[model samples]
Every structure is written in structure tokens, then in C-alpha cells.
Target: MSKRLLARVAALTTGAALAAGAVVAVASPALAAPLGTVNLSQTSGLVTDSPMFASAVTSAPCPTGFGEESALRIGPAETGPFTNLTPSLGGGGYDKAPVTANPNRSFQLALGSAPANGRWWVVVECFSLLEGRHPDRFVTEIVVAGNQWRVPVVEATTTSLAVSPASPVEAGTPVTLTATVAPSGAAGTVEFLRGTNSLGTAAVSGGTATLTTSTIPAGSWSLTARFTPADPGSFGASTSAAASLVVNGPAGGVSKVETITADVDPGAFTLDVAQPPAVELLGGQVGGTATGALKQATITDLRGTNAGWDVTGQLTDFTGAGNIPAGNLTWTPSAAKASGSGAVSAGTPANLGDTRTLCSSAAGSSAGTFTCDAGLSLSIPDSVPPGAYTATLTLTLV
Candidate 1:
């Protein structure tokens, strides 16, 4: 070979050999990259200063084949004593001592009992004894605690009173009123009132109360009740609407005509005018009757457009549950007659009941609660008990 060619060849060979050596050195170190770090985390509801929790340590890694002298460094300062460190789960392989560090390795710590209130902390650390290695840093620290929860609730109730027929009459008609209180289980008392007068009172037993009144005049009246609280502030109070009473007049055509005296209190009125007695109905249901003298009675028609009169009534059973009603008896007198005279119209229902009274304002006016007077006969529904049943009619004039 020539000298020049031999020099070039030698240079080329040295350069290739150097490149190959450098490649091999880099590859060897890359194969075993040093671990970046070891991390630890924990969670629990248990209080501190107690035995460690078994399930508190969620993730922990321990180096494999660790020597007896090797130790783990956990926490910020790594100053806590490393005693009682163990796997708490029963029959767990990581329970006993001789714990070794392994990738994806975990240990269930045996936490002491929980404190009254607070939490527990568990930290996992790792140390290395490898030659020329730096001091072991914290691998990881896990914090865990228990959960606290509760359920909230709200309660409510209402009180109400249902009066039969709503409208009332006089002449001692029987009237029934019911008071209902809600919330199922509550203790309280209920009071009954007629206008501003106290009628009676009852104690609530199982959230219900009932009352009746008799001897109520033939004028409009109101019934009201209030419930007393059982626990002062524990529960709320309740009230019921007023029950109405109506008083009816004597039969028509027996003229001992009486005048509706003024002073009939002024709120509402419910009155019943008796059917004209001994009158004939030439071709109607009340035809064929005429043996007695025609009678006349005077009533203060407070409901008349003039002289300040507006009255209303309802035809219903004592229970107050039945078909809707439609009937009203009104009168308009010439001039401002305090007491007017009117002939009783015949054909009223035998068992007729009614009520009338004066009201201070138009809002309290009631009418249309009258029955057809056909005869002197009285009747009751077939469902009515065989025994004699009495009802109260009420009225309020103010």
C-alpha cells in the first residue's frame, strides 16, 4: 500500500472504533435508569392519638430484598419513631416484619383507635444503602380520615273547622262542627266561639275535636275555634272558621202576626218562615187544603235593598254533605219600613229550615237558604235513623 492510502485508512478505522465505543457506554447506563422518586399517600376518618387504621395506607412501595439495617424516611422532617409499623389486615402477607420495598407494593397500617374528634396521618418513606448513594428521602406520606354526615328534615301542619250547611238558623236547630288538625301526631286544645261569645272549649285528643250547639236564636251566628299549642314553641297554632245558626218562624196562615224586632244583632241572618197553613193549591203538589184562617207574620227583612238588608241561607243536612241548593226568599218594602208584613207563601217543604240576619257590610250577606212549603207534614231521608233526631238552627243579626 502507498503511504498516503495507509494514513487515510488508519484514520477511518480509529474514528469508527471511537464512535462504536461511545454508543455502547450510553446504552449500558440507559438500561437501568435511576428511580425518580417514591411517593406515599393516605386517607381516613379516624381521630389522631389512637391506634393506627388498617385501611388508611392506600399506596406504598418498598424496595425489594431490603436488608435489616435499611429504613424508610417519611414525613417532612423524618423525625417520628418508626415503631409498630405493620400490615393490619388479617392474613395479609405484608402483615409481619421484614418488610421489603417493591414496585406497586402496599401495606395496610394498623392505626391506633380513633380519637373523639380529629384525624390520623400515615407517611411512607424509603432509604437506600447502595454504595455512593445519597441519604434516602421521603418516599411518600398518605393522609386519611373518616366521614361525618347527617340527615335534615322539615315538618308542617294545618288546622281547620267544617260547619254543616255553612248557613245557620234559629229556634234551637242542631248544628255540628268538626275541627281537624294536621301532622298526624300532635297534642293541643281547641276552643269554640259564637260571634264574640265563648261557647265552649275542648281538649285535642289525637288531633280532632267536635262540638254542637242548641238553643241558638233564629238569627245569623258564627262559630270559631282555636287550637292551643302543646309544646309552646315545639309546634304551631291553628284556627277554624265560624259555624252558622238559623232560627225559623212559626207556620203561616195562623195570623198571630209577629214583627221581627229590631235589636237582632247585626252580622248575618239565617231564618226559616213557616209554610202557610191550611192553604189550598188548586192544581199543584200542595193543592186541596182550606180549613183554617189565613195567618200573617212580620219579619225584619234586613236583606231588602232598602233599609239595609241582605240575607242568604243554604239547604243541607246536618252533616253538610249533599246536593247543591237553590232557593231564596227576599222582600222589598215600600219606603223604609223597619218591620214589614208579608203573607207566607204556601208549598214550603215540610221539614223546612232557614236563617236570616242583618250584616254590617255586604260581604256578610247571605240568602237563598229556604225550602218550598207544601204542607204541614215533615219528612227525613230514608237513611235517617228511626229514632227522633234533632238539629239546631242559628242566626246572627250583627
Candidate 2:
């Protein structure tokens, strides 16, 4: 071995050792820093009537010497530049340190006030293991999550009305009008109106509002209830269906008669004759005679001299068996009398088809009482079925 050979061999061995070290370093994997990710509790499609809440969670524990940083922001749908909210993370401010017991940091955001009705988005950003006064470097590693929230407006309430002494009430009589609002929890006032004329206003209590009035005139009137919401912005107003009211004039002299009235009594009959049993035929003919006693109509006339009165009667056909023929029934007024200085005229025999005058008085008359008596004869055909029969008799006086 020579000196030149020894030097060359030493240099070559050193170079080979350096090359092997470089290859080993290139095969080794690089080191990665701790990363953070945010997961929102509500991703989207959240509807709220009042306040809402959301939570953000991190993927891993915060880095050493750095606390968790979080913020909440909200904006209209499809819009940018969201507005940040002051959130209470882990029951404290954003700058507060996270609890060590829970490795995955969790923060809660409360939306105390709801925005206007429509679509909106809630965005949350959480930075884990952040440090320094100016933490721009940590911001790039921040985790963000967003969700769509909806705050719908309250629906309008419904209203209903009821009027006492429904119809044909005497004028000057006290009448009560009640208005009820649906959704019992509704708070508002109701205005009573009579065909666009304000009657009065009443506050709703226990879902009902009432108003009393005695000044309604004598005529047909339509009453309505209009509701006014206390918070127009929150709840809408509504109106109720109209209620009909009919008022009558006071009882007094119209022209000459101070007062005139009449009373009518219905006629009844029971066909139970042993000798001739009544049998209804299919042709609408009666086998035996079925006679009904006469009905009475009494009239009280209070008038001066030269006063006259007339009475007319209208009869309805038997309703059984699809309306029994009207001509089958006939009416006759047998007895008629007048208590005053007027003669009472008897009524002619007439069928139930047309109007018939049953009684009349002379032109000259005074305060007196009049009485009328009538009888009914029924002729049922064979065609009429066997069933109960009914008819109505109407009496009018003038």
C-alpha cells in the first residue's frame, strides 16, 4: 500500500457516506401542523318563530398556549358582507379560554332577536390554537360552517260575530253584539259596525269582545266585526262574516187604528169512526169521510168610526207522499160574528190552491172583538201513499 492509494480511498469513503445520508433524508415524510375544522349543528333549512341557537364544533383539540376563537355572522339569502354577532362561547366571551376536559372545543351562539321574515344564512368561524395580538397567520387555518335559517311571520287571526235578539226585535230594545277572535291567545280590539257605521269599540278579553246598543232603527241591517291587531307588524288584522239584524217599530197607532192584532189556532182531527173506517187509497181517494173541526181566528180591532177590516187565508198542500194534491183539501167558514157595529160576512167554500177571504167587516166600525170559525174536508186519492199528512194555514188581516 502506498501513501497516494491510502488518501484516495479515504476521500471516496467519505463521499459515499454523505450521498447515502442525502437519500435517506429525501425518503423521510414531512411533518404537518395541527389543523382545525368546524361542524355546525344546523346545516340548513332551520325555521324559527322566536329565538334560535346554533353550535360549532372543532375536529381536534386546540394547540398548546392558544385558546379557541369563534364568531357568529348572519346575512340575507344570497348576499355577502355578513354582520358579526357577539357570541358567548362556552358560557363566556370569544377571548375566554376553552375547557380542557373537552378535547374537541364546542361553542354556542344564541340568536336573541330574529330578523325579518324570509330566507337568511347563519355563518360561524372557529379558529383553534390561535395566539398573538395579530393572529392573521391562524386565520387561514380557521374552520367555517354555514346554515340557512328562516323566520316566518305570524299568520292572521280569524274573527266571528254573534248578535242577540237576532231578528225582528222591537226598536229601542237593548241588543248585545259579541265578537270572538280565534287563536284564543290573540290580543286585540274589535270594532262593531252596522253597514259601515261604527257602533262601538270593545277590547278583546278571553277571546271575546262585546258591545251593547239600543239605538238601532227599524229596518234590516247587516252587522260586522272588524279586528285591529295590537302589533300590526307581528300579526295581521281580519274581518268577520256579517250578521243580519231586523228591528221592528214601536207598537202604536199607524193611521186610524190605535192597535190591531189577531190570534190563530190550528185545527186537529182523529179519524177513529167504528162505522166507517177511513182508508187512504193509492189514487188519492178516501174510503170514508174524515172530517176535521174548524179552526178559530180572533181579531181585536181598536179603531174610530168608518173603520173596516178584511181577512184572507192561504193553505199549503199536504206534504206527505210527495205533495198530496192541493185540490183534495177544502175549507169553509161556518160561523162569523162582530162585537162592534159592523156585520161579519161568512167566507165561501174554497180549495187550498188559491187565497180565500174568510171574514170581512163593514167600512164603519168601532173598538170591538171579531170571531171566525172554519172547517177542513180532506179527499185523499188512492195514488197517495199511507203516511202522516201535514198542511199549513196562514191567516192575514188588514
Best by lDDT: 2
lDDT of 1 by residue, 75-99 (tens): 2223443333433222223312433
Scanning candidate 2 in windows of ten residues, the lowest lDDT window is: 14-23
Cα RMSDs of all predictions?
A: 43.6, 42.9
For model 2 the TM-score comes to 0.31
lDDT per residue as tens, model 2, 2-52: 000000011101000000000111111111121333444443342341123
Off by over 4 Å in 2: 1-152, 253-398
Look at candidate 2 and tell me the lDDT of residue 132: 23
In order, candidate lDDTs are: 0.33, 0.51
